[model samples]
Target: MRISRCVRWPAVVVAGALAATACGSFEGSTTSGSGSADNLTVSLQFTPRANYSLETDDAFVLSQVGCLETLVKYDAEAGALVPLLATEWVQTEPTAWDFTLRDGVKFQDGTDLTAAAVVASLQYLLQADAPPRAFTPKLITSVEALNDSTVRVRTPEPSALVPFRLASINTGILAPAAYTGTGIDPLSHCTGPYTPVAQTPAQSMTLEGNATYWGGNVPLKSVTARFIPEGATRATQVRTGESQIALGLPASTVPELEGDARIKVSSAFTPRTTGLYFNQSRAPFDNPDVRKAVQAAVDVESITSSVFGGQAHPAIGPFAPTEAWAPDSPPVNRNPDAARRLLTAAGYAPGQLKLTLLAYTERPEFADLAAVIQANLAEIGIDVSVQVSDYSAIEPSLLDGAYDLALLSRNHLTDIADPLGFLTADYSCGGGFNISQYCDPAIDAQLSAANTENDPQRRNAIYADVASQLQADAVTTFIAHEQTTAARLETIESFVDDPLARYAVTPDLTVSNS
Candidate 1:
């Protein structure tokens, strides 16, 4: 794991010292945290992954483990990018960049970190069957290791967001030896602050501090990360002191934690959205009037504020809410009158339209949303039935276009600074993440132009047009972006609420109880 500091203990226990003679796995330091309970635990929101980059949703949980070594890391202290795995890097050409790897860095498996391994890890990403492989890496032509500690990556054109993409946990480096079977054995990748010692289903994983990490040893001798998918019980774990930290607490329960002085709440703009994607190539979805009618059937504001307790924002289109490419299309409020007119224009009468919706059980809220949406649509002459199952089932269902409509929550990264990352995957036919199977030659042309375009403003305008066009076409029912909430005991230090959390660097992060 990456460490920025080092410490050693003497033979005797010294007063006010972190450790005595016996060495433990964690650490002997305390930052600003007041509570250093003998035992500490954190509740995880999802299960661990065997394949890293293939599944974007798993990044949040996997970030707790090892990841890729990049030229820079998010400098939370400075609120900008700072040197990390790479001491310093020089930008040669807009697309062709050179990096000088840090000296004396070692992987978790005793392998010295080198440019060769970094190159291999990126090649692995390019080879993956995931959408990013074909889309992002298609812009890349070569990755050459100039020396043991220097590497160069050459892309098709100028890429301003390359560094940001490098910082993504999904792009974290994997040891050359870590590759096993057909894909990455993510559980064994060596580059993080901690690694798993014991794993128990529906229970907890005892993560011991990585001692050989160059980044520095964690202060906690061990961290027990429990997988708690249940929303109410997850919050209870934090409120009742069963666990010091709870991840993904529903916003409805935030007030309960706020009521407790011992608990602190943290939240950020999550790159997640709950949406309904239509099979645009088929049936009623092919009709623009039917699509517009469906959009007007849902009341976005009430659904978010009332059901999510103000934890979510209405989604307007494919672009992330804060993205520059996000269009000005506001949430379509329920307009039964308008919906009826459109439905009639499409030759659909009351109760004449029927559609099936597919949903997954990965999130506790998906079923609830589907049920609410199904009931809501019944009032607007549409009949919907939700087919719920595990994520594995839902994924294949979406890919095969088995369901007329589907409920999906997708996480996004700032690939190329805007919707290029998501649209290329979701809107293009045969695209890796294109569950909707949507295909519009004009939309594809615009997206393709934005991909290679060097001008930022021009690219954003192109993507904005794509967003507006998709809305007008009714390719998907843009629901809302559910907020991700984190609750921790007040004793935790360096508590910064964020959309992308990097808690490993917290002030108390290095502190441990042995």
Candidate 2:
């Protein structure tokens, strides 16, 4: 799970009554508003990492809080695209698609959602200083307003997944007024069911239901989302009735919450993986044999069992095993002997090489995982020093390739529902978020082919091949596939357990007072 906050709490208590005071205190605490059916309160794991920039991953906050709406939404269950703001879409040409906007849709700012607005919103994203990874100028060439209710999108190459690209939260549509010379102001310039009326930077955001929402009357009058990083605190908030909904609960807190009568715990296999990435741009890691040796040193099964409490399964590739694109290979067994041999082949003598393993505290499990990995590497005669810090502090160094190794939890489908976008943006030569700082022409070729392949079967086959290549290259050690878990008050109805971590608050959601 992607979580944030600079503070690191004491080790989480596994199964018992949590001392409410031990979870630490919030500066500005608010009631859950459970006394009234018209109000609701939610606790989220991540705070705004980029000050709620629509161009960055912060867009997900807008999406989950119901303050933003996209042209299309991905229905993971149906394995198909569904209309949201746009009523229907058709491919006019291999590289061009025409979308028909829903009639009478209005932004929360009381402005009409016209084709011009859609064009402007998309243009803003495309022309951003840091374009969204899901769809950039590299893939999308232009968006033109054909008429008052129609728009045409053209891509640089023949694309079959334009609809899927539009479904990404990063591609969410906003009113033209939201854009400014300095930055975006999404207070009332969105078309979603809720409108942000108040915020406290990294603390919390309060949203009021949009009366003119095109989806019909929203069930709640107001909603407050608190940004709490500690998983135990999030659980305590839900248990104490301070919040009705708590998302991103740590696995260790599940057993305790499951016993609560008022709270209902929900979990699902997600397309997220925790990985140990090597900065290939740096020293020893520049050698493929060294990377392979490190991969062989780590025990994935032990980490999954001891650190995650069995909430996660050993990952064989970047994609989750439950995902259709995942390869059917068995998990790699731990082999310290093989690791030592590889190190010898790579010209590294026992105890000759020393490296740093960076980890962030937001995920909670990273600390434990880091310790286990450090011990495992020691057995292979590798000296590893573990460094734990907040993700915010570690991000710059990770991106700059200043770190030797790092632990990262990534969602393969966050950019788009398909793994194609993830593969391209994370592993390709010019990938924007290539933390590994590793590149290969063969992998790039496979990703390029998958992007243009319209046939689902062929595209999936290409993805499997790329996965095999990545494993063979030992570009990164795929640790484990995570299971997303959340706890909510039983009184909250129509709660969506979205596997993609999108659309937490919606028009159908309701809170019962009795």
Candidate 3:
């Protein structure tokens, strides 16, 4: 059974509550079935941001709890789009594609999952100011339900990779009741293996196996997921048996926990990049010389080794070495003298330029990276004042062009399967998430062409060129490419970190209490 309730509170209160709470035994599994262990408690790095139906930040959490489903799934290893809700699809027209969904699936609300429901979910996501922002809706022209199991999506132009966009959590298909006149209602109107029983925003959530779940019997009966931002605290929780699984463990603790017999650490290279976003719309930063100066000032080696405790790799480009398109280039060398010369050329003298550096504390490494960057820039005569806050608080200033520089950890695979979506959003003019406000007509034209190119090899070549141009322009200082590390108990069987940062606890997961 699914129960939906709204829990509204100030962000301050949520933070305080999390800080005060320690790991403790919660409710047990409610589902009646044979499994190794009955119930499980998991810890996450970020809480679900408010207005989930509209916001994209917490969709991964929603999907992990089995409360949401996307039309397709991208198999990163295979480099292909596999079926999820969408069983098969074919391009009916140059601008349109028709999808055949798996039938007999029902939402937690008992509503028959239909093609119209898919259209409604997609429509709500396309609306401006929606909670979970998506670039997919911008490319789409219209959606129509051809039959009970078939839905057709038409783009403004011919798009060969439309299915990839549908795989994003931002486009998760929800029941009609989930969307209200105001926006998306935070309810468990999803079609998945489990349904949400109770949800407390930024606090905790409870999910139970859907007995009528279309998928086979869920391994674990129930799951209670908590949002614990502090990595050390999460490490403590998993170590103390307060939680069986913990996500977003700090690198500093990995050594300590890896030696322990009770704990196991699982990590993988995520399509996530840590970088400095230079606000090109602002003064000093607007000048290419200044941008290059700042890029050259930082020592990425220290960031990857000292700051991350050697858990991360120095970024060669937007795509990490894990990605096939990552360029075979030498590491960026720190040249303080050249940086000073460029600053002088850009009409800035030593100690003359002062700028604000913005960052958030969601990922603890970012705050540390910001401090290192602050120190690195200071050596080159640039005065930088760092402000640390929640991501929600910092994002507005970034989008409004109020910030001079932003230390951010962005996922390249968040939107579409290819890196082009990430490049276009960060480098192209009029990009929805262009907080840096960097734009180049040549870069934009090349990326626009790459978006529709069907051939994978040809598309990769285009992306390689775009990466080169962005690197030469020094649009932003690429810091490190991150690998997601999680702390898990030894009892948990078949544990793996999803490269996409979703699907942590799937039907494959099992637990052995003995």
Candidate 4:
């Protein structure tokens, strides 16, 4: 799920929410089952970025998730990383290993999956200056084409997390064609269960199944995705039968849906978190007390019960017990009294400090939650201004530090079964999605040390220490690790979550109307 924030409030304030509703990159989707409808229409919270490229971020990649298999794909059902692309992998050394490609597989584009193509896709993703660049495949030092279906990937240093990085969305497999004509640009060519029909950013996307796909042919003849930002209206569409599958339904609407037997919600925890971001590089937040005051003002018990209802839990930390890198000692999540003392010592007066809270309006529940928070903060003597808008405006607001505070969310992959990949992305000084812009040399040193340590217990200890310090710094307020509420028609069977956030809907699974 690619959660995006809405932009609003212009220069005064910016409000945002975490809502991912588009499907363009491949994850295991639509398992072997019967079609609920000859044609299926699913509604996403946001429109796809584009349907034009076979690039990992493109819409088709959503359709082929977990199937094209590289090193591994998240299997929610089994709660582990399973193989799809490479049958299996072995560690040659700390920094080097060879992947023996799965044989007899063909791309949806009908091209064979060869060693050269694999090499190309791997290199393109790791080296490309695009979204996949966020994957930092550059951690890989070199690639060696061992044979027609074999390639050796080498890292400059001893690192066991190499293959795990390849399981991210940005690492979705690419077709040979996405390479040939594209001048070293791996963004074109395509691969997945369904071929891209067409896509218009901020509008909609349509897809068709590839009959010649090596995995198998799709059941539904067509899939059209509409981008609808209004949460209530989208929920109504599900109720009225205008939309068959509604992705990213607000938590508040879930209860009503649960009452409607006609609908079935298939939900799982996404490796994502909804939280309060602190600009550690700047003031008040730079003062531990101010950060704590904000934390104290947040009533997660109230937030969870009133706003989230029964849908979510008050988040104590980021990684669920499922993550390989989940800290054995999670950060201290609650310190309301300490928060008060910190604010008092920081010389802050109630209502004296007014800050902007940024969020998007697509998920109305979050907007409502912000209102609740605003009221709660007011009780604590902190004044907060609420700003809400479309996703377009919220991003720059984050980068420019236009608002004193912003409501943000992150969707990441546990591709390697550890915190190494996600922590690196979230903490790197100039990371791809380091919204907080947190730059701590000490933290970075710890992360780097963990990366090079091949010993499991020792590495986890290092990561745990990093997590502890961040907690002490109140670097960020950790909220609930959301368990998504997604509805699949009864005809939908094999859909499962890999706990790690990746899913697969391959064609090998049969779909019947029943």
Candidate 5:
């Protein structure tokens, strides 16, 4: 992994900085926006790890930040599907789909975007060494190049959301050079509005607009992005003019940043959900009664209102309220007494049961959420110790069953339009992200049925049934689905938050000169 140092700026003069920048009343020169036609700097909440192609989350985010392009994209504002590398697509048969590649599109390496390249990129995602295993939809059986501009997709079962699946970051088409003997070349072989000129793995990256891009008018010429994992640091970058745009500001910082006239805070409700995953392979949690007890002990309203400042909606199930297939289920009610009773009946001694709760500090609120759970579980006679660290460090413990419970945030519909992709990835027997090591044959059957079902109504009904079953079984306890937030200079006019985090850095965004 190649690590690079991030450039730092001097302390911000926040006393009257916003007033001076907004009103243009200061006499002396003040550092503000780029004040140019096509140059900007953004601060990202998450950083890219080494081997970008192997990591699905890194690919999903960087693809939007101008590094790579997906075959299709979702327009959150329009609530419709938009074209990227693939211009048009259709379902020729129940189990087969066809896509026509956009002409004249060139990769960063000057290679043409062809059907064979798309197939190779998709194939790379299924490699044994892929970081995010099971990123692609499980229904896909094979990908074949029909012609220079056309591609065919085959699924083991009839899939209605094949186009949506292709639009995922895991399917981002790459140049042939990226497919090396053993791994993918991270900084090369990508096609997007912007191309990486320099990158520091997990720290910062510099990008220049692609002249050969098929997309219209690449307004932004250059972008320097610093990955500040700390939320407070990210907000600081926005206020200090070090970063023109800051993505993923913590909810706690929104009120303070909103006070600045020059800093604009924006948010959009997304399909992402934060929840507590129980390791069923571990003792006590292996019992369904104990899992239900922990679920009953949690207070979702308190966490949403007090911890999040009411910026989020309590999760009813895996799918958010914005999802079309979300079941009209009520949020879990807090029942400490019932939780204690269940714990005692499960042959656990009072005040002697102990467990370790693991959580990462990336989201800023995760630590606080863990504390809330700690306090809530204490009442039910479960002694809990919280361990907070980075996700990379905690992931090993999660996978190996070193922790009794894990606090995880997941986007249920980011990869696929339907929630099945996330369900199968996080819950099934072969789930790649299954931290809890949970496997239920009944739930697996329901997920398979939903994936193969062609009828929309029937598919959704099956998904609803699976959601109910998961909740009833207490596979994981849903906390809340938060609204994605970003902070930028008030001069940013065309900044729009895409729910899936794609289509964020486009040609239309511009900063006002006035």
Candidate 6:
């Protein structure tokens, strides 16, 4: 377990000097429990946007609470796919993969994990109302149980990323009983360390440790995950001892948490990028020059310093510079003069272009970042209006191209821990999650080439070309590569920070009374 500590103490000193006692005390907050040693409460950043469905992004909620397990898991540190429910896998053919399931594994429902069960779970996802964005029917064609211990998956095309696709939490295996007439019920039907017992819609969920977990004896007796969308509230819960662990603390709250002796704040660079996406299908962004002009107007360095408090690195592209696949290039500097010139070329006079910039309040820094961008764009004669709302309320408008510009914090590795998944789902002509409404045949061609290239170096080269094309087109102005910050009580032992933001509570996590 390597930990990368964030150098935020200097910023704390600066903050303290400006405002004395800025790190105010959090008292009288609602606590999760009586602060029991064996009982752990975690504050999560996102509530279940969907109805806790395994087929949607809500699967991540299940994984974070240790109630879901995928066949394979991404080892962010190792930068490779590792075994989870599946012990080993082999590419038997260009379009086919055979995964050997681990023996002696049992679902919390008391059913033994089998190849048939794995096939059933995947089949459920394939037949879902809105299939998983990672691997839909377009990608995967069939799933068959070769034996009691082996499952074979066949894709429509030769995909080297099949293993990584299976690693997505949306494909998490569950017992057959989980599939109900209404929807998938994960309670007591998963093969993870914890079994979800109760849930309050969009609020909180309670889970009890699976004593018969295949991995080993679960260390924590119980775990409760309270989904608080407000980052400050999550931080306050951890600070006031209402929660033992908190995920996704805003940068503004880090200094305050650092002042607490009982709390340990851990930060690590992740494969996430915060960017302002343009609705390419609509005007004035329909014009490439306008998109470029907006890109040139953004002051990424200032936003990184002021809003993130130097906690994040300015992004060079969609992928983080620290990632192996990221292109080796210089950061794009803001050029307001060029922005003015480009806007003129796009036939927009000074103060003629009025645009709406939408940002979600879930990420508190987004509001601050939007203000800075609004000011920057105004300098180049673009009049911008900002709208702040919950992400759930804005997603429909984003996907339908109803908005002009949107601020989004996207994790490239969340769907599949590879660049291909992000590239295909977010930039392709018919991308499922293409909020930008961007489409370029040249970039799509590069993505196709990367999808088929099995060789790691060659595949990365194709993606590098795609990244270059995306930047040149100004499809979205990548603001900064964010680092995930988590705060946990000092008493929590073996608390590992997942750079991928997948698994949080695990079998080895425990609490110490002393």
Best by TM-score: 6
Clashing pairs in 6: none
Query: Superposing all C-alpha atoms, what RMSD in Å does each candidate have to the true structure?
Result: 9.7, 8.7, 9.4, 8.7, 10.4, 8.6
In model 4, which regions exceed 4 Å deviation? Answer: 1-36, 50-61, 64-71, 130-134, 179-189, 321-340, 362-364, 400-402, 412-417, 497-501, 508-514
Better of 1 and 6 by lDDT: 6
Which 10 consecutive residues of model 4 have the lowest summed lDDT? 12-21
lDDT of 1 by residue, 1-514 (tens): 0012111111111111011100112222321212354345776666644334433544445465333344556542333445667765555776766767777777766688889999887776676656352335666677889999888878777664455455655556667776664554544355666655555543555555567767775556566776666767778887776677777667667787888887777766565677887877688888878878878887777778876777788888765546656678776777878988999999998998889988765566777778888877888889998888767656766777776888877654433124566677788764667777778887877777776665667777887788788877778888887666778776665544444443432314532332
Residues 1-514, candidate 3, lDDT per residue (tens digit)?
A: 1111211111111111112221111223333212248777888778776555534667788787667788788766555667888887777788888888888888877888899888878777666463333444667888889998999989888776677777777778888887666545545578887777766656777887777777778877788777777778888887777888888777887887787787878776788888898888879888999999988999999889998988789988787754557666666799999999999999999999998899887787777888899999999999999999878888889889888999988887777767766887777896778888887888888887876777666777787778767777888888898877887787888766676677777776778977
Task: Mark the regions of model 1 whose C-alpha exceeds 4 Å error after superposition.
Answer: 1-39, 49-60, 65-71, 74-82, 89-95, 131-137, 182-189, 201-203, 319-323, 414-417, 501-514
Scored by CA lDDT, what does every candidate get?
0.64, 0.82, 0.75, 0.60, 0.74, 0.83
TM-scores for all predictions? 0.83, 0.93, 0.91, 0.82, 0.89, 0.93
Tens-digit lDDT string for candidate 5 (35-70): 475778777777665456544566755665777777
lDDT of prediction 5: 0.74
lDDT of 2 by residue, 332-425 (tens): 7889999999999999999999999999877878888999999999999999999998788898998788999999999887898788888998
TM-score of 2: 0.93
At residue 388, give the lDDT of candidate 4: 91
Off by over 4 Å in 2: 1-34
Q: How high a TM-score does candidate 5 get?
A: 0.89
Q: Which should have the higher TM-score, number 3 or number 4? A: 3
Q: Across residues 1-514, which tens digit of lDDT does each residue of candidate 6 receive? A: 1136431101001011112110101112233652777799999888786656777778888899998999988776656667899987888887898889999999998999999999999998888777888868888999999999999999988877788888999999989888776666778989999988877667788888899999998887788889898999998998888888989878999888888888899888777899999988878998999999988999999999999988888889897765657778777889999999999999999999999999998798999999999999999999999999888999889988899989999988788877888888999998889988878887888888887776777777787778877888898899999988889988998987787788899888889987
Between candidates 2 and 4, which one is better according to TM-score?
2
Specify the poorest-scoring 10-residue window by lDDT in model 1.
14-23
